[model samples]
Target: MVELLDNQRTFHIQVKHTSLVLHVLPTGHVTVIYWGKRLESKSLAYVIQDIGRASYISDTDGIKDFKLEQLPQAMPTHGNSDLRTPALVLEYADGSRITNLRYKDFKVYSGKERLPGMPTITSGEEVETVEILLEDYLQQVTVKLIFSAFYEYNAITQSVVVTNLSKSNVTIEKVVSSNIDFLDAAYDVCYLSGAWGRETHRQVRPLSQGAFLLDSKRGASGHGQNPFLALADKQANENSGSIYSMNMVYSGNFQAIAEVDMHQNTRMQMGINPFDFAWQLVPQESFYTPETVLIYSDQGYNQLSAIYHRFYRECLMKSSHAEKVRPVLINNWEATYFDFDKRKLLSLAKEAADCGIELFVLDDGWFGKRSDTTTSLGDWQPNHQKLGGSLSGLIEEIGQLGLQFGLWVEPEMVSPDSELYRAHPDWIIQVAGRDPQLARHQYVLDLANPAVQNYLITELSTLLEKENIAYIKWDMNRNITDSGSSYLAVAQQKELSHRYILGLYHVLEILTEQFPEVLFESCAGGGGRYDPGMLYYMPQTWTSDDTDAIERLPIQSGTSLIYPPISMGCHVSAVPNHQVGRITSMDTRGIVAMQGNLGYELDLTQLSTEEKLLVKEQVVQYKEIREIVQLGQLIRLTEIENQNQYAWLYRSKDATAFVVSFVQVLARANTVPKRLKLAGLDAKAYYQVGERICTGSELMSIGLKLDKPIEDYAGQRWLVKKIEK
Candidate 1:
């Protein structure tokens, strides 16, 4: 409830807790350099001061006096709980400014007092609990960065740094990824990733109107791929494990810098949206990303990717994981998209009921009177032609076949030609009489409508009651357009965007509660809808819709640099793919797919004899190492972006299992074979390779060699079945 520097140019201040709105400078800098939180009436006091104990300072290179220009503080005219964008802005001495700095790069230095009955913090005390308590340590947090930048049409290497001058070691983990809203003719998310390395990385797939880094590239390691410029090297070297990012759109800009220390266990994701810049995270050291660099782009995919690399080198940081993740997962979109009746579904269910396939999903055209992507959006009903009856009925049928049944829905959209739209014309988001705009030939539904929200909940709840539906595929295709809303008052217009997202959260929370067993996969036209906000509801996500396995190699490779493989959802689809039209080798395709939640997306009903046999063997092999792929340690043995080679590793959940994918992109003679020493093995046990057996140490020591050149860019998979004696 305090205000810092409120001016058109430079901003400076000290506060217990405050809301910020900083502007963007094109010099490649993080605008709001500081320290921060909360929702509704539930949020009261930001922080309490220790009284005469906590101090402040802006001392750094090229430092200057703090200035405050007279600026009117407009009344919100609504409850804080209703909606608000507490933005942060950064200004340079030379009259330049930028906004949107990562929360991770800021630091706080102050002593803490035990507010009677509350946990205490003291030096050398095994790190007592560190909470952003409303009554105590809120204001104690200060924003800082070793090297940062704010940019508008360009990047400038500016740096800010803050330290924990307090007596105890500050623990600052849990700054997760960001959730942002965009406003435009139609908002877009043109994203990119860094250089490719060996191993399978998920790719960024285009949504109807936006693009996102699907799969593993949504983390700090992933930021290396964002198409943004980096801070100068000397500045970036000021601290290790720091974060850098740029957020901009066709008309806006934001950037940030955060230096992370070992003592603080907090981690966060960095990125930008059209309207806002943010980082999301849980304040737990249990698991998170340490640092990252995020950027925005305007050009198509290629140009954006190059921009992402411009900022990659400066944001590099080594990443370990809470655990490895699954890479391959079977998607029903290719297998079946609103084409199956109960009997036909049952037939396909039997095909996917094998040991290799983990989950079987039914894609779009499934619910809400939706026969196609154009209608039945607000109406969440299963078309009789496809379902015959209830979704639950189909779920039960699939269960009988011993497979997990997954259903798809797009709750955030609506169609003018459908019942939901006609019933509540006001429920659609349009600029008054501006004739609702459309993307993918569809209009966006206003979840901002309580009536719309209730309908979605009612429809979703009714379906969940049918039987055990193991998974839900939440898909969103377009960005918001014609932002004016009839439902929200003028004062509450800003709330429309955030509220639309919140409304999504409310529904998801309810569904998750009603059916705790179901695993939700958020797919925003593949990755557009991807944000930490969804992760709060669904643990796993579909990385992208571009299923060309070869193009996906770089995508997945780049993705894994930041995300765990298990969390990535990849699939082996037919060559001459539906999108990219690339016909890669079946073995090469399966090899790429095996790095994820392994499953097939192509039609299995009409496979050729040899294809069927090959697929059968693959199914059997995947089943054998499923555990390792699902929850193991992932090691990228090759750098795909750097060379024509592929190599990656996954060790079992118990650390007892392991699998390695070695694809030689180009022939190499005496290229110093990379020896990936296996972990979690019983050195006590001997490992035999091929005809001749070798010690586990020997294999790790010498490794295998390819006999012929990997021409036509072909490869092989060495599945090591429990070290043979």
Candidate 2:
């Protein structure tokens, strides 16, 4: 609920267990007085006091004792007495960059307000919001800081809308979605950072006096740095201590930063990466920044992650398959990389159907005479000659075999050897005089162009309308380079990156709404575009292209830091593992893949009789626990840093069952077995695991024992069902 104490000039935005109190100073600057545990509606003006003109800190508004530099400001501005990082900076036509905004007005609303052209929390309509308006009268600019509090999700969404009310054009040099200040800097910083094939590795360090930046300037939310950041107490862990986290609902270039000022206070900000980014606002035009989800939990990282997981599952995702049990499918990427004929795919699909798989995904090379990745990206039409039939004919054949059909298409990219690019070379993002750089032998489509958007909609709609496609692996295999749009004017060239993301969101919005029942799983090579923004359109993402079970432990574990397990699309692939060449047992691979939405990605026809039987049994096992594994509350049973053994627990929504998955990456000889402690079980309930019956208390305390004399890259999973009286 959002409460405004007008008499005391304070606004309190409260979720279920958290509260953010904002107080308007006598000089009209809104400052955050408190933002931690929930507090009642009262005058919090006394919570903040100035340092009274310390060295290098000057007075403001003729108030000797109060200075903007020392206060925990709500909307800090540039070129002001506040010497720390400003949340906003506007450049005017006269080359002036100073913007001092004062509180002008405010509004309280019942339901959450949606950002005009962005992917955000829209599923939850019962959220409360308080929008505080600040204006710089000199520049005729108004900034609205919007805060939406989600009661059930225990989270808040923050976004900014900057409007240019002046007659002249204004340039927004920097504007973040949210800026929060903490009175103390005694916290540790945590973020997800890694490279391609190894995305979302958790990194943590103590927050010192300087600034720490987690950003993605790779045009995509690069695999190098994900758009998630958290501040935890010095002694924080999975189950204890205070934690505050933020994730941007955006897939473009973004920045999440924490700056420690000289006063030992920490300032946290998240939004579009200001580096090489600028947006021009014409008169009467408003620029809406993307939304950022903020969550605070005193129960540490697990609680913080639970808030994000539930919020994303309930509020962010819009696909009809969001809450359903995902189909167990096999993608033909690794099975037949660009070298499959109609007969080859039919054989594979036949074997998959015999193995009880529910879906058959025909990956690349089925379109546009595409024998290799160097050609035929933008051409969505199927190569009927190569398929020996029409696209629908092939799909109908697969469907007759008791499996749904899925297709892979890299629609956002254009191969230079394709017919589409030949007709419209200007459709690619490129500067007028500079040669466009290519990644993976393809150029990114100029998504910012309305012409391009309409063409994609028309082509994709035509194909999807004609064929009974159940799922689409929408992949963008390369990051954007030579970032310039032909449709945009020279002055707006800097807006191409964000504009591309907005355009992508628009196309996805229409297509997903049009085909609500069709499951859409996004992939950017694998996991590079795995941000909350994509999850809004596509229910899940291909977790990583690296399908090795042992290598996936840290990747999936770190990704689950902010994303739910259900949103990860994990698949069991061929042995010698393909990516890392680490040969693991088929049972271990199946158990690891079951941690998320289960699938297979290898040549099923090549599996031996025994291996094929194992695959069938794995399918049966996954179907039995699919719902609980997808919708359950996930808790990290062990730290992601534990290289020897890693474990996690999932409790059913009704708390009637629990599943724990553990993997031993490398077994040590003559070592004692380790015990895995579980969490979030009904303390009084008794659960039956196979033949063993144990109370929840015993499960949480004495724990489950690991298999002794463990083999290399071994894994195990147990389903504990409550024993009713």
lDDT value, residue 14 of candidate 2 = 92
lDDT of 1 by residue, 1-725 (tens): 21223232212222212122222222212233222111122221211111122123322223232111111111110111112222222222233322223232222223222222111112211111111101112223333332122222112121112223323323322122222221111112223443322222323221232122322222111222332222111111111212223331100111221212122111112322214222221122121111122332222222222333222211210112113233233556676665666676666666666434556777778765665666777677677666888666777777776677777777777777778677778877777768877787677767667776787788888877765776677877666767766887764564455456556656766777667666677666564433333444565656667777766677676555434455566777876788767667778777887777676787666567687777767877776776677555566654334556667777664544568776655566655545544433555566544566556666565665654654555667775545544
lDDT tens digits, residue span 470-548, model 2: 9999998888888888899989998999999999999999999999978999998789999999999999999888999
Give each prediction's root-mean-square deviation over alpha carbons: 14.4, 1.3
Q: lDDT (0-100) at residue 464 of candidate 2?
A: 92
Residue 640, model 1: lDDT of: 37
lDDT assessment of candidate 1: 0.46
Winner by TM-score = 2
For model 1, the stretches where C-alpha displacement exceeds 4 angstroms are 1-330, 336-338, 354-358, 389-393, 665-686, 690-701, 707-713, 720-725
* TM-scores, one per candidate: 0.61, 0.98
